[model samples]
Target: MTIRFGLLAFPGVQQLDLTAPYEVFASMDDAEVHLVWKDTSPIVSATKLALQPTTTFAECPPLDVICVPGGVGVNTLLEDADVLSFVRKQAAQARFVTSVCTGSLVLGAAGLLKGKKATTHWNALDFLENFGAVATPGRVVRDGNLFTAGGVTAGIDFGLTIVAALRGREEAEAIQLSLEYAPEPPFHSGLPEKASVEVLGRTRQRLAGSRMARQAIIARLAAARHGAE
Candidate 1:
């Protein structure tokens, strides 16, 4: 049986968030992976890498898995009716609804994460509560059919987890072996808890601008929702 997977490809997306999973999904036998967008036009990533969409929201076939990968672009999607609608519509039928990094925020905005245990990038983890989700911490968190990953590099682990769930541990391990998925960072400071105070401060300072922008957007969304209620 063919497993169809769709990953949202949007402007300013973090390329690794999409591609890491794409590589894993593509390596599976009888698995079809798509880069989906509102249109087939080329979109650029946050790092300025160019990506072409294989299908549009309207043109894409029913997918077994629908994944959203996050980056600076996600703040815009939080308020984008079209994008939220597309995700909501797809999540209604997809076997697995998933996201990488702050993409979980998009799923939350679409009302899929309410009361569900989910996780996103550490910087954005606290924001999940605004969507009525229990903010869980992990490289990947799975609550029933919803799968979410942490920041950028965690997508690889998330993808392999999905593969194991769908195929088997052996197949997932084989894929991991093929990809040589091993972690060996020179610095042991991937997480806030692990980083030195100086390093963490610098990192947070660099991210403060985007973090503040996201906070404003979330606040606006919350106000709009409350007004609607």
Candidate 2:
């Protein structure tokens, strides 16, 4: 059986978030991985890497898995009706609904995260509560069919987790071995909890603009939702 995986590709997306999982899924035998977008036009990543969409929302076939990979682009997606609708429609039938980093926020925006335990980048963790989701802190968090991953590199681990769930432990392990997926960071400052106060502060400062923008968008969304109620 062919397992079809669709990963959302958008302008300003974090390339690694999409490509890391794409690598894992594409490596699987009989697995088809697609870079899906609104159109087939080329889009650039947050780091300025160019990516071409393999399929559009209208042309993409039914997928076994629909994954959203996040970055600065996700801020715009949170309020994009078309993107949210596509995700909602796909999530309804997809076997797995998944995300990386702030992509979980997009799922939340589409009303998929309410009361579900999910996780995102540590910087955006608290924002999940605004979407009525329990903000869990972890590299990978799974609640039933919804799977979410933490910042950036965590997508690799998330992909392996999903692979194990869909295929088998042995296959997942084989893929891991084939990719040599091992991590050895020279610094212990990956997480805010483990990082020195100065390092954490500097990192937060660098991310403050995007974080603040997301906060405003979430607040606006929450207010609109309450007004409708």
Candidate 3:
């Protein structure tokens, strides 16, 4: 039997978040991976890689897994009715609903993470509470069938974990071995708390504009929700 996977593809997505997991899944037996977008056009990644959608939202199959990857583009998707509707519809039937990095924000926006323990990039963890999700700090978090990866590189770990659940530990191990998925970075700056004050400041400064934009969007959404109730 074939296990189908569909990941949301949009403009300005973090390429590694989508591709790293994709490579893991594609290594498995009888895996069907489809990049689903509004259309079949090539979308530019945040890092400028051009990726073509394999299927349209209208043409996506009954996927066993639905993955959403995060990037600067995620802020725009927070309130996109069509995108949220698509995710909610897919989640209704998908065996595993997952996201990478800030993509959890999209899942929360789709009303899928209510009261669930979830995690995103460290910088955005606090925002999870806005959606009634318990903000967790971990490399990868799984609440039932909902799996969310933390930050960027965690996507590889997230993918292997899901594959192990679906296939087997041996299969995941074999795939990991094939891909040489070992990690031991020379730097200890992966987490904000561990980073030097100078590193943190520079990184935050680089991400200032996007962070500000996301905060504004979150605040606006919160106010709108409050007014509606």
Candidate 4:
């Protein structure tokens, strides 16, 4: 049987976070990958790159996997009723629900991570607690059907891990070899604790404004959902 995969797209999505995983899944034998968006036309990335969606949320099939990727756009999606609703519904039916970076926040917004251990972009782990998730520090954490990965670049690792789970380690290793998945960062600032205090402060400052906005929206959504309950 052909495995069906869905990759969600929204405005402000990190280009690499979504594409890297796509390349992995697309390379798999007998897998059909669909870019599912809220729209039918095109979605623009945070970097202003344009991507066309093959399917809209309303038309997405019962998926074997649903991959949500993080980016600057997540701040806007925090309170988007339609997007959250689609995520909740599709994830409920999906065999595997996966997220990268702040994409976990969107899954949390969909009520998928409650009482579950999950991880997100290092800078955003505290926010996951706001949704009742136990913030983990691993590059990838798989809890039942929900698999989450940390930060932007971690998507590559997360995808490779899942590929091994689905197709076996040998197949995944062959693909990894073909892709030359080795990484050698010039600096040791990838993780939050590894970075210098000054560098962390500077990076936090750059994202502070957007983070605050997203936090506020997340709080409001949580409150609204609580009130309904």
User: Model 3: runs farther than 4 Å from truth?
Assistant: none
| lDDT (10s digit) by residue, model 1, range 1-229 | 9999999999999999999999999999899999999999999999999999999999989899999999999989999999999999999999999999999999999999999999999999999999999999999999999999999999999999999999999999999999998989998999999999999999999989889999999999999999999
Mark the 10 consecutive residues where model 2 has the least summed lDDT. Answer: 181-190
Off by over 4 Å in 1: none
**What's model 1's lDDT at 97?**
99
Candidate 2 Cα misplacement greater than 4 A, ranges: none
Clashing pairs in 3: none
RMSD of 3: 0.8
Scored by lDDT, the top model is 1
Clashing pairs in 2: none
Error of 3 at 106 (Å): 0.3
**Candidate 4: deviation at residue 163, Å?**
0.9
Total clashing pairs for each candidate: 0, 0, 0, 0
lDDT of every model, 2 decimals: 0.96, 0.95, 0.94, 0.89
Better of 2 and 4 by lDDT: 2
- Between candidates 3 and 4, the TM-score winner: 3
